[model samples]
Target: MDPRSEELAALNALGMLESDEKRVLDGSSLVDRELRDLNAELELVAAELGRLVVPVEPPADMKRRIRAKIRSRGGSKLRSISPLALIAGVGWAAAVALALASIWLWRERASLNQQFNSLREAIAPVTQPTAEKEEKEKPPARNLEEELKKLRGDFESQKTALNTEIEALRKREADANAKVAQLVQEAQAQKERDAAMKLHVATLQSEIWEYRRSVMTIVWDASKDQGALMLDKMPRVESGRDYQLWIIDPQKPDPVSGGVLAVDDKGTAKTTFKSTEDVGDAVKFIVSVEKKGGVPKKEGEVVLKEP
Candidate 1:
């Protein structure tokens, strides 16, 4: 016999099955001998319980007392009675019925109570552990102060990092601004130097000297010890030779070497030269061909001379 069939047999015997379940149990009981036997035993037990549950009616005098109690509680008629009044009437009727049943079953009441207590004690161990486990699984409460302190520490760490990043950016911006300022200063100084050179060239052009095959122009600023040179129609030098300029100063015994000069493809050259020594009393200028790097002494043939 299947366990489900046995359960259905028990329900059917006690008259607790729905109409559909009752139909299924009746059909199964015809073929299942164990289910049929179990159903028969359950029916016998239910019949015995039905016999033990005696139908006790309230006496006439008890009914009159209940009506008097309801009237005193402001319920004049049954039709006008509230649900509470109806519940009170039912409770009183149940009490009277229970009193009569107890009187009739007084001999069995002690045995039944003893059996009920024994059953509760037997089931206590299984139920007690489950209640204790549920209590243990519940989460403990959090401390508000500790949680707030952790949040504040995290916020302070983030704020410090942010402030450090901001300071680094400020330093980088300051360095960039300083570099831009330096470039601006250098550009302004370059512009002033160019203007001074142009002015000096104009002054030298006013006092120019011309030679037989080439023209010479000199612009000397004794205060700064610098000058500009301009030569036109000058012959190009050999591969290992270069043209050099000499400044003849009355105070110096030897002519001071000005600098080396090179002619372009057009046989014209323009350059600025500065002397290491003072040339405050220069009286004449000369050009000579020398080696690629000019010599301190004029050891080459003079090509152009200026008064």
Candidate 2:
């Protein structure tokens, strides 16, 4: 049986398969005996889980919500963008990196034009021009400027989408954590290993830059032994310098490197980083400005950290 069929079977058992996925699984299960048996077993497991876990009651306003949704169905639906898409498209959606690059390029081109005009003025004094260089470049410059404007708009839209996704992810994580906490307490003795896993989330704001606001957030997934760092309104690092993250474990004496950051000019970055050593229940997280690639140990100026 195909592995895809196996997954669809489990989702079907839980009544979570979409209409299209249900069709695929139904067709596959007809021909795949192993997949059929797997589905049957999973359906039993789902039934048992349903019996063991208390079901949550629907909201009192569910009917009102349904009616509102029905009325809103006439309007075009908005697509839910994933934050991970920003990570993958890192540069363009990457704090609208292409927008920044394009702006930089536009400025450089404009500077070159100014220099060309100055040189032309210097030459025209010595020689009478038979033909003038018509302003043929003006149209291209205008088009480029228009493109930059569109990119800026796109950047704002992507930023808003990222913010919404981050909030939704946090809410889902909170719900899952609450549920897991209850289950861990109830079955700690039976499954101490699983119960030991944990997650940490912290938000830090800086006051050093009095003019602008800066925010940093870290989400530590203890089970995965990794963490993600998100920054906004941060100050751009100086030339030949980069921002680095440090994970401080109480068991260790020094902070471990959690990878160098690539922040855009506007002081925004999002990256997943890990330490050289195990981050067993991190005590704290620190951000600092380091040389180009980062150092083995934190020998840079500490800029932000958790209280």
Candidate 3:
């Protein structure tokens, strides 16, 4: 028998090469080397097919009936497979879509996590205290209590020093106020001295005016016996400088001065005088250089005298 036919008979006997395998055999067009290799492999397959006893031949009519049954089963099986295949294909497509969505979500989550970390870093300085504060909170490696005590002592010392300086400043301000008061008193005294000097000057001027008015009323006439009542020419003087006359009595201890008189541009002084005593021979008139106020004593050379 052909090894392929023998192997098919063995597979039929073992119930492994079922109606589907027979249908495959019926549709195949394998030949030559391919057929020979298939037949050799079939022999080996047949050797392992030992579950049932082999029959020499299936009846020709039975083969026909079996082929008809296989066809019918194939059609029904194709119908059965259609819904499951459709469901499996849809399940696979949904699984692939879910996997892609999950991957996209994972990537986006990673990106968001990176952004969150960046924002956290950016806001850290504003949200947290400075490094100096952290160092203050952290205890020193050694002598923590001692260092804190030292700092407290230093702070107290600085506070005391500031208070002392403030007190010294207050004292300096008091000293300045005392000096200002003394200066004010001195200024008041100086103003009083100036006022007193001005009053004295006004009194002296009044006295000089009263003395001159009294002297101008003293009148004396030149006697005809006294060299024909001679009048002489007067000397010239500079601006604001003038000559004055004095009256002296040989009988009195001090001379009585007369009113001040200045010569006009023509160098002439005319005066009318009166005397209490009738005799004018005892009084003599003397001319001397003087300032506008008249001198208390005779100054410069005597310019003229009447005796």
Candidate 4:
């Protein structure tokens, strides 16, 4: 049957048996199958509905907000214009203003320059000073020592902070390296585990394939002893219940006796047929529980079959 038709039939059957789940089950099947068309139809419906939903006016306070912004800018522009006007004053007035400004600026510049010179002089070599010059500079030397001490303290504090930051960065780098190593180890282990699991699964699949290819259920031919079958592990049979082997024979009154066989956990069994037995038309071979020898009766389902 077509997969789609089978699926639809199952859904219809379920819906008929349980009416309540009908819409829940089938309501969105077509929609899911034609998602693009559904989305387009939804968009069209939304657009049509949007036309009926009129937009309300913006809040009245927004106009007030705009007007307030304009007024604020107007005030700012007026302030900015005052500086321009001062710059564009009459040339005579500007000259006089400039002259005063230069004098004041010069005074300030002279003061700053003097301060800088004094600082440089204090930091420079202290030559053998004359008595009066030495007396004049003694106070400044004391102040300079205090300034140098303050600068040194600041430098030491910054150096300590920088050292602390460097140590923290080193620790972070070490931790990152350690974490990377751990992840690498984990990844390697995971790869090994995955490889082992794949091998185990492949082995199981191969064994199953071999089991599927076998034709005969059981065989008992000692003449061609296919090497002594290894008896790795023996199954625990019940008391007085030994595994019996038999062969179907048309010439004989019934299936002929083969020999006792043993089964192991690996599903392997072995038995040898009697050499003198004609072994004619042995259409079937089987194992069963009976006396401590072969049995002529079957008391269990056929676990294996021969073509």
Whose TM-score is greatest here?
2
For candidate 2, the lDDT comes to 0.71
lDDT of 2 by residue, 154-252 (tens): 767867777676667666667767888998887876556544546565555454664136556676767777877677667878889988888888888
* RMSD, candidate 3, Å: 69.0
Worst 10 residues of 4 by lDDT: 198-207
Candidate 4 stretches with Cα past 4 Å from truth are 1-133, 199-307
Q: Report the lDDT tens digits of candidate 4 across residue range 90-189.
A: 3345456456655755675567568867765785576655787667756765665566566557656755665565566556667767888999999999
lDDT of 3 by residue, 1-307 (tens): 3344445445644457655444333222121234335655665776675656675786779988988999978976766554335455545655665566557656755665676556556766786857875564444323444544665576567556655655665566677678889999999998776444321000000123212211111223334111101112344655666666565656655445554565666444545433222323556656566777666566645555431
- For model 2, the run of ten residues with the poorest summed lDDT: 78-87
Query: lDDT for model 1, on a 0 to 1 scale?
Result: 0.64
**Highest lDDT: which candidate?**
2
**What's the CA RMSD for each of the models?**
51.5, 31.1, 69.0, 25.1
**Global lDDT scores for all candidate models:** 0.64, 0.71, 0.49, 0.47
Order of candidates by lDDT, top first? 2, 1, 3, 4
Runs of candidate 1 exceeding 4 Å displacement: 1-211
Cα miss at 230, model 3 (Å)?
Answer: 41
Q: How many pairs of residues in model 1 come into backbone collision?
A: 0
User: Alpha carbon lDDT of residue 239, candidate 1?
Assistant: 91
